[model samples]
Target chain A: MVETKVSKSQTKSTSQLEKPPSLMRGLMLSKITSWVLFILLSVLAVVQLLPLVWLFFFSLKNNQEVFNLSPLAFPTEPKWENYVTVWTQGNINTYFFNSVWITAASVLLTVFVASFVTFAITRMKWKWNKLVLGLFMVAMMIPIHSTLIPLFSFYTTIGIMNHPLALIITYSAFNLPITIMILLGFYYTLPREVEEAAIMDGCSVHRLFFTIILPMTKPVLATTAIINMIYNWNEYVFVNTFISSDRFKTLTVGIQNFIGQYSTDWGAIGATLMISIIPILLAFFVLSNRIVEGITSGSVKG
Target chain B: MLYDFKKKGEHEMDKVMSDKKVILLYVLPALILIMTIVYVPIILTGYYGLLKWDGIGEKTFIGLDNYSKLLTDSMFWKSTYHSFLLAAFSVISLGAYLLVSVILSGKIKGSNLFRKIYLVPMLLSSVAIAQLWMKVYHPTNGVMNRFLLSIGVENPPLWLADTSIVLYAIFLPIIWQYAGFYILIYYAALKNIPESLVEAARIDGASPWQIAYKIKVPLIAGVIKVTIVLAVVGSLKYFDLIYIMTDGGPNGASEVMASYMYKQAFRMNDFGYGSAVGFFLLLIALTVTWLIRKLTATKEEVQY
Candidate 1:
């Protein structure tokens, strides 16, 4: 199935590059080599996923089973109670909700602001546009640890030290550079005629941007939003540093503390870790293409 | 008539788009956020390093003391060494990622599925990865030791407990977590190369290895340089996994600069000293980024 597609593309490319369809050599590997490479890739795929599979298995087993049986052995009877206990007894529910809301709010804030900024820099005429863009790009290189001390001090002075607002603002700010970077490529490729026609028809800048530009950029916006979602969802340092109370903490930090109490219980620990990661894994399964596209577009232009 | 109207439209378009008020409305929300959140705090970090306050105490200006102290601090230097070691490991691993990407980008079946599968580990949070790997490295019950013991090996080298092997042990998970990411990046770059270019080379009887080495590699040199910068700088700032897995532990054998700074500030409450370390980390990151870019700058851009 794949070989025919490969040869079809190769034939078209070769015929395009060469004037005559003279005798041509195969552009792909032979059957044996292809099989060898395919096997190697499959091995890597297993290596990448084996730990998670093992975790899921152990999560269903009691201590005796986890210890006595083969690592790959299925539980004789799955202990679904591990998941139930963590959800009901531990602070997993609070952390899960906090993670969801905070991740959503940050993604929304980041994408909205980044869209405007990218639109301004790429579409709207401004003299300091390049300089401002440079500032954001340079900020991408600044280590968050460098800002942690001052940010902590600033939050303290402002009396928001233990606030979830702290995490939201920092996530949005730290993420703007990358979000804008991804949007920059898409914005640049957009035709200027749309904005020109809207202005010619007496539309205000805000009107045109809100109605036309915003909707036009939905695809790239989805990419940046997913990228932001992954980042904000997985973020640990800010949540660990700022939010003190369990109610405000996200899954990343919450799971750390949750695991501390259940240290010796492999099944409970496995459940806790799985709970922390399931949201992201679910998103990846649904939107793997956009995530790949987002990451590639985000970094390649760097 | 049509030309004049079009010219007038252009003039009207410029007026609306270039309005300063509108520009600020568009740019300031994000600009202010970054400035106050990112830029301002960075400058303040440098200032905080000069104080002697214990996070919440009255500040006493102690100019250059913290900086000078950092210069001679053995722990600071040791942590910095560990950071560079991680950077070295990360950079070395890029070669492996590139090789996998080169093969995966070939005309292989289920390449898309393989790429996505490789990316699964990367999507999980570092804390999750850290916890999972800590279990995987458990001396008695970990999958690692179990496999070793089953194969007739008596001692499996307490992976994270022994100082000599802890750093390397932690690095294995780092490789696991990021292998998909770098491979995805390289694969994307390889796929971007014009199909016609590769076909032309193939017709000239270039072997696959020769084509990959001589053609594909040089063309993607720019992406390779970017990945190098990402890996090095990312490693320098690396804290989460190590912090979770070891907390730079078993007597600080695996301590890196970021975790060390984190401990000094948050754990030890020596905010001033942590600021000093933090500021130094910033300087090192920026300098390394610039250094890599300068070193890899070609006389002429790789123009395809």
Candidate 2:
């Protein structure tokens, strides 16, 4: 019986394969095989998204609903107020603003500094160019954990341990390697004739970099900026260590403490977590192509 | 037009491009920042390991004592063992990621959308991922236990609290968080393979599996080696999720090297010992990275 059933399906598939050669090529696999592959891919996608889906549902649910209902069940009435409560009750507002400004400041600082350095290395003829480029490249491999203890002491001695500047400067310094790596390729491929002409026409190096070269590199700048923004925004260790005051804490660490206060309040905890992730999600939706491009360009060539 | 003065202009261009002051002006700020922030502190970490000072106290140099203690400390060794375990798991999982990328890079429908969906987890903060997974493993009320109960099982293992299974429990989220990243990298590399090569193999009657195994994989061997280094080094330095999720807790069951170093310095105030662990971590990361590159060195890199 099993052999007959298999033979029947085989005959059906053979009939299906009688289509045109172009269609067969487009199919890439037999109909049965392609369906199986597609289904497997879909299953993987669902598994990847299930946790976030569950989180969104639980955020709308009260403890009673969460503890009683099936784990996958949807909330009958979405509790939008859970968001309002978490926003008003905790220091989440302060954390949100801190994340926004610190991420912005760090991204700006990193892009400008990286742009200047990349310009010098790629465009300027200088001794020690390869050594300097290698320095930045090697910095990417040094584990941040190794630098923590001494950095903690350095900030203490400099009296910036608790200051937001500590977080900003550290974010920019560590991020410089990847940002410059991304910019280096773009800078190298850029047409030097425009800048060469500008210089020959007595344009100062500063003017050439700012007005002509900088404007031309805007697309890559955006890529580096978004990449840096994501890293700075999601950063936890620096904020957790450097900034101890409540007012200065970013969302990453602030939400950790905030959730502790409401250990049993599933709705509130879920809402807080959602709020922390929403900005990144929004950025992803709008600029996903750029994010994908930046990540690939940053790592692939290495 | 500029070719008229190309000869004399070459000298002028050389002078402008190589100006000492301009180069210094452009490079100094970032150069100093990296030197002070990254380079100096790593050196200081090695130096601090030689002292026996609390963070706030005067230093008394006790050369090699902390390093010697690191050699004998069972807890330090345990954490180091756990870090190596995580690295092994990360390297092993790269195979699964590569397989998925091979399929996704094929002429599958909606591959772009599928790639983005997989990447959602990678974009979220580690704290959020940690916090969310905490709920998923909440023992009594989490999705895991709930599903287990519904299937007529009377008891489900305490995912994060049980020491034996806690490391594996933590590994699940790490896999979840990084799956899309590795998949994306491999997919990009696979996509970069010249289509003509795959077409030529097909014309010779090679199966898809045979094509992937023989032609595609060999061509992207350089990328695979780089990823191996990334996964190993990244796993060695893994901290944030484990720190936030477990805090190396429940009798230090899930302690890894980075978290252990953090606890020693920050929580326990043993700055000197923490610096030792931190320096050892740096050494291990650098040595393993170099070792992997040397081991995986091909006589001649495969080029198309």
Candidate 3:
């Protein structure tokens, strides 16, 4: 009797489960919802990509075609010469080289200096390590706008106003706090026994850092390099303030001149933006995973 | 043999320490750089605030004059009020958006794809985002107005042109660009919540809302605090987008503290008043951040 009752209850529960439409029905509903979501997401993605697409399309269109035709529609004939014209007339080639040189110099300096400070703080026995860490944190909190006026004054006094190296140093210094924080996290996670063994083997502090610690921390260094590169490459405010010459203007400022007084040439403006963003996009695409990891680590902690 | 080697090593270490000064030498470059770049600028700004000088000229002492003028400056007050409003709007909207996105991120397939799509705005430079949105918000030929018109609305408001609606319009783009970041943060925190608790709640017939409120929200309080702090700080310092979009006006309606100060310093060349505005901004940011930290302090340790 008990077995019969139990079987009856089990059957009732199973029937209830199956009663809310068949399994096929449930699957169909889910499939429909998933498709709907997929379509929605795709539309959103396209919307996000529209600006870039517009830029590319405009870049290939002449100024007359751009203004005369629908802005959303493709050009009837692609003007390939516009690219050549923007490259030459815009002085983008010089700006591109300037950006590359400045970004590379800044990245190298930041990575090296930040890694050294992080290594000393994390790995070595130092009396003032805590103080240094606190200082970096405070520096990170201080807004750049507050210091810009005074910094301009100071830079002018130092006679390095338009110099690329000066900009590199300033960028590196501004970027060091976050870089050190990131590298410190990676450095602290390193196994202590390796450093101990190195010390036991009579490796000096400098040698130990250069040969052992830095090699293990290459992933983070690469991450830092990529981040600092993107920042310095695209940085507008500092570059705008510090460098005024046409020859020395970074891509950010150089592209701004495209929007001249009366009317912005949409075609030229769009083309310049596309050209300027290419290097950054390539770098981001290559180092996307590292970038994600670095940002998450820094952001979550901060 | 061991004792002899130990004695010799001790003597060598002493010699190395005495001769090399390794620690100081190693740290000197970073120290000098930080002192010059970070500390000196901060100190100098404060000192410069006391003087009256343009970018080119020498200083004249002006004791408390900038500060006194700041008290009565209608523009300064308007900018601060706008900043507060922006902060409030951002925190509330972004907080809700992040919460919804985090919940959606969990049950959805292709969540990483969604994350990457959302993160595009954050990855792009602020200038690019600003310019792109400017096109979208264009009055006659813009996509937004065109869409509104297509939807059978007879007229669409001029976004940045309308003084009343301009601040809110500007606010939307900033929110769009940054919401993804907060979504990622909240999602990370949610991922750390043990699935067992959620499953247990489900078995107990707890609804999704109940599970979220009772389990997830309380569990991820630390992350929420951090998100709020970041949002507040970011909102206060927001300038690039506004600068590029409207230059803080059709009629200074969208002016925030940062933009106002930038205009005062660079455009108006009022270094003295600009310095005052800068200090005021710094003070407000610091005070708000400190207050948030104090308010959010808890003794209960949050375990993953």
Candidate 4:
């Protein structure tokens, strides 16, 4: 794609130039400049990934080695024991499972509910459609802090404070807007023929949505699911605010306390942090394009 | 070919699709959830601001006293100042991200991989980023100090522990976390420009700089304005990294508005004052969003 775009422009410019020597020199100079730009871009990429690489390195090192050896050095005998020790001994294992289940429940619930709303707003006619859509859109900008006090108080009053249900429900509610936004773009461009054809065959509304619409939207479902999964897995504020129990806390807050207790154990701290992030990293490695597409579509159009 | 059957088909579709019962079934769940979990609490924040109550105790009718006290609170003002300071720095830093995006949008090799690499930090949780960066800034064993000492520096400054420099120190990781997000947005926008327009400019002997500034920037003005609003409003609510890295520590040098409000309500149990601060944040976010959209509202957007 880049070659075509470049060569198309090069042909246009050469046709206009009519001077061979200067034109060839110009192409050479432009190629050199592009290589320079590419090199700088490569360096920027390195800068971005260096910290994580260093984290991985030191997660395998003891405090003595980390302090005495260079910051960038590989461990002489890599300590796979660090991960095993943290995972089995500390609260890290419990937090890891909690993050996984909570993240899964929230993402599934948020995406399904959001899909329902988007289908209604885009396909079904209602008097309050625009108003309801506007409400969700506006909610996206309401600072989460503004809602924190009321949410905290409400949870305590309802006796659900410190419950994983509280985390799941809050995650689902907050993520509804962006999920709908991404789904809305795809839903709007969907051809009505498939739905119309299904309706003509006298399919029930439930069946139509489940068998036809939902199945057809697998790509977007993956997108919203991945995005929500990332958000919920990494969520700290809500879990910290509501859940105080060590057994219930997600990795984010749980790891904070873990680090607090083992303050001087760099290997343990590093390993704990790695456990917290590995799920999201794995999700990105597999579904990166969908995540990128979801983010860009969710924001740029808005 | 035929309007009658098509019209009949459309009428059937709309009639079935808009069944009030099904529509209600579908939309009502999400609407109710957001209202109870989001909207109701949004209004309740301001109402709670009028009360003087701790999280566990009985409430007393303060009647705007908390709000009034917020107006006079020095710590509140300082936190607000720090938030706005971060906002200002974020808006300024868009220039650097824009530069990177402009280059990446060119015919550069591995641009796809580069952007993805840049986005790695963004994908991680704020807690993880904070923990990693805390290690990076550890006083004696941290990567920053070690590197400085390796380069023959006699002394390295304390990072998050130094009250004077903690806020600025916190900004470094914040910058690292967000650079890729802004770059991704700008790169996507830049890619939307028609290749023919750039080709025409090149054929006309326009330097790359002139083409970029005189033509490309004007074309993507709308996106830039959107990004400006995002950066400013986002920075205003920034919390996680600072909360983890410093916990507004070293005597409150890094207390942004969100963290300050969290500490007040959650830690100090000053629920009334915290409600007031939260309400103030909502107002500023809405106002800043409106102000930027109005200010950057262009009369005529450049067409493709």
Candidate 5:
């Protein structure tokens, strides 16, 4: 293919330009040079993690100690009760539960719907397939702010304003393009032979997709699922603008108001933030590779 | 006869797979929903900018009035400048990310762990990141000042409260949150360069710096361009953290386009004006994305 040949020729220059290195290579290869670069990288890594560490320390400290002690020091006695109090007394419990269900519903809808479209475009035959896919892809470029006002008025007019359905629907709709993009690459990689054999065995189109093709795409599905879950869980602007009441707010919006109420209580604020981020942190611990892959594939091609 | 019969059965299977009804069923759900929820609203936002009505009241047509007002609005222009400034800062910072990523991709140990740690700030909600960073910037009992004090600095200027320095202070966490993402992207790209090519470069008289600058960076120019588009347009839509952290505070010093639009709509109750701001943001985002892609685009693909 021209594509393969083009890339080979691009690398050919670097491959063919070889000659024996000169004596100056000895000084250039000195150990100190690489070590200095390594140390710089290590500093960046530490800087990235320091704020969370500082947050944890402050989370355990009450006002007396937070005011008196060093910002980085561990508290003499950890007050894990800050977590318990924020969970029980404040509206955090409601927000936490709301986030769980909304995130679940939205993730499921997004992945399934994205899977459906990806399946159709890559496998099933259609005339306007590329055009439709283009529509979804271009939708990614349209900023959400552009859509917020009309969506707000539309939801209000339709009488679904302030409802969880509003949040779930918007999440599902907005996330569709990126989800489809991630899945599209995987779907293209899938062999058509499996679906062909199933169709030869008299399997219906729906069954062919749901049973034969979908199972083969599990790894990619997981990637898209995790991506969707993170976005849905951390979403802010939609919930803030659309939802007005306290009972229905997600953690992002909820925490903003919760912190506003508990403004002076640094321990509780820190504890609340820690609780909100733990799931994502745990998820990263498990699936960092997939997240890296999904983000790269989704962005690089765009 | 047997061969003909088998071929006929294959044709039947192809017919079922390409069934029009099933294709519609599969794609239409997503297509219809996006049309109503995403595309329709985008069109409406442009239209909404033309009206002189409150969000709840009857609409009155005012052709180009809000936009004309926007053309001369100093506050709006100021916010737009702040947004562009943030975008410029983010794009310039990518060089540091690229440097770190290049170093990491040179067969380093524990690079995976390093990338994950860098991404931790990115995973948290903006509100949570904002709240944690608010503490980090706290004047009296915060970690930043504590460090400044320990280092023997005479005066630790207030971070979030100082108008001139507030925007830069917020940009730190933006760097923290996105540094991992860009690094991960760049690292992956660098790793994609073939080992044989690098070996060939090494055999020649080129040093590591030459190989990195002359060879590696050129190969990943496409990815670099994509990140530029992302950071610039993304900065235009900057809201959550700024809204949660300073709320465009210290006398609107940190106001970006999205946060300004939010304030006009939600705080000032000027729905028409806010729509104009939001529409302008969308236009700005699209234009910048297009312009970056155009400027960075190559006629012949930079293969590999």
Candidate 6:
């Protein structure tokens, strides 16, 4: 309540200053220019949204209707069956499951590993902590594309080719640096007194981490988990290169196969795209605030 | 009492030391994981670039032959040039869009709604966006041509089908998808600008365009630098969108280094050549990022 009153007062004081007539007119002209700018931005925003909107309209049309009719026109008959057809024939149910399992496992592993590492580095006085942090920063600079072939070769040599766990491991490795960086930032913000008190109460390091630190860091963990889950679920190149078998394919790769070189079934493609994005959308909706905070904080920092 | 105190003090110190060790143990697992997956693979890529091995065959020493070939390879040079063009287009367009959006965000009604809508494309997978654009750029019945025809512009050029326009055509979807991200960056930066500055400028008879250019742009210059660096790196390493949309098609007009490398390694089974391409890409990205940093290095620390 006090904070609200302070903010309200600040806002009031900030808006009270007046200007001369000429200055007011300049401000008015600025307002007019701003409105013009707003309209132009709105138009551009609509153009940006056009593709997704087009996807929805095309999804409702059958192949014959899609090819023959106007691309932007609403379907004469909304073929809702296309959704079912794509779901069934595209093996999206299995792909969805694969995506879920891979994403969930990868997120869980990455967050767990990253948090543990962050907990250790920030809490423990290790001599090589700076070195370890530097190593992770270097890891971020190495583009994943450069390493794909070598990783595939190594995975094939190990005979874990087409294994879901292999993909999970790869995702976890790539995701670790970002997760660690985010969790480290969160951990830094945490007070040391609680952990110190826990230590005095004869709490084991493991118990302390599980009971106190983990619970306190839930928001950051959730953000990291969701971000990792989104990336893993939507990732195409690695999954496509690593997982060859239809059984092991994630939704992104599975959906890609729907679009052959010869022809693309628009309805099926749209449905598959929708199905593939549902998990990410669901996760985003649930954790939108945390995700937004995490991205802005994480990406903006050096 | 003295014996008890001594024992307790030893126990506390031991606990401190043990806790430190435990922290190391916690960090060790992740450090090892990253090293094996990231660092080792990079070193191996460099090593493999020095060898002449089909991915399936026995490795043979090739020294710097692959790297030398990359220097002279027309296709490699073409793709590099194309990547630079794509990066330049993405940077300029994205920067412009971001600046416009940031200015609009100030004192605009429903700006929050606009921001949310603007960011939707960023949320969609690149492959999906690429596929959607491929449909939009279709030759006979594509939306682009249809719109052009409706506007009475007959004989609209084929987008992806035409060799000349294919690279730019592929770039359109990428720019559309990524512009929102930079806009958000600029928006966040713009929001950090003190309202008093704008108000003061207004009271001094400054127009909005002048305020935006002379005030907001200068303030958010740091973000612009970062955006340019990210754009350069991202475009240089771009693959999925192009691969999905055109597969660097219409006589390889849309090929970038990463896609070209993928074709070389996977399609042609020329692992050495692919590695060279990858190395060149890495070299260029790092050099450009460094150059931008050096150029944009500022004395004032603008807190945002």
TM-scores of the models, in the given order? 0.95, 0.95, 0.89, 0.95, 0.94, 0.91
TM-score of 1: 0.95
Writing each residue's lDDT as its tens digit, candidate 5 over A5-95 gives 6655554554343322323344345446667777777888889989999899888889998999888889999999999999998889999
> How many angstroms is residue B144 displaced in model 4 relative to the true structure, after the best TM-score fit?
1.1
- Comparing candidate 2 with candidate 6, which one achieves the higher DockQ? 2
Which runs in model 4 stand beyond 4 Å of their true positions?
A1-22
Question: Of the candidates numbered 1 and 6, which has the greater lDDT value?
Answer: 1
lDDT tens readout by residue for model 3, A169-221: 88988898878877878988998667656665787877877898889998889
In candidate 1, what are the lDDT values of residues B14-58, reduced to their tens digit? Answer: 888899998999999999999999999888889999989789889
TM-score of chain A of 3: 0.87
> What residue pairs clash in candidate 3, if any at all?
none
Q: Per-residue lDDT of A1-302 in model 2, one digit per residue for the tens?
A: 67656655665477553322233334455656667888888998998999999999999999999999888899998898999999989889999999999999999999999999999999999999899999998888888989998889899988998889999999999999999989988999998788778888998999999999999999999999998999999999999988899989999999999998898999999999999989999999999998888888888888
Q: Residues B1-304, candidate 6, lDDT per residue (tens digit)?
A: 9999657755664577356568767987798889878888777877888989899889999899998888899988898899999888987896587666666557777776676667677777776777778788877667888889889998998898888889888888888887767777678777878988878887787756687888888887877787787788888888888888878887888888889989999889998778777767777777887898899899887763
Candidate 3 residues lying further than 4 Å off, grouped into runs, are A1-47, A63-71, B1-20
- Interface RMSDs of the predictions, in order, are 2.0, 1.9, 4.1, 2.1, 2.1, 3.0
Return the clash pairs for model 2, or none: none
For all candidates, state DockQ relative to the true structure: 0.65, 0.60, 0.36, 0.63, 0.53, 0.44
Please give the lDDT score for candidate 2: 0.91
Candidate 1, A43-136: lDDT as tens digits: 9999999999999999888899999999999998999999999998898999999999999999999999999889899998889999999999
Q: For candidate 2, report its TM-score.
A: 0.95
Tell me the spans in candidate 1 whose CA falls farther than 4 Å from its real position.
A1-29
Q: Which ranges of candidate 5 are over 4 A from the true structure?
A: A1-29, B1-10
Higher-lDDT candidate of 5 and 6: 5
Candidate 4 per-residue lDDT, tens place, B86-187, comes to 999998899999889888887677888888888899999999999999989988888888889889997798999888999999998999999988898888
Residue-level lDDT for A227 in candidate 4:
90
RMSD of 6: 5.0
All predictions: root-mean-square deviation over Cα?
A: 3.7, 4.1, 4.7, 3.5, 5.8, 5.0
Model 6 alpha-carbon miss at residue B243, Å: 1.1
Cα lDDT for residue B108, candidate 1: 77
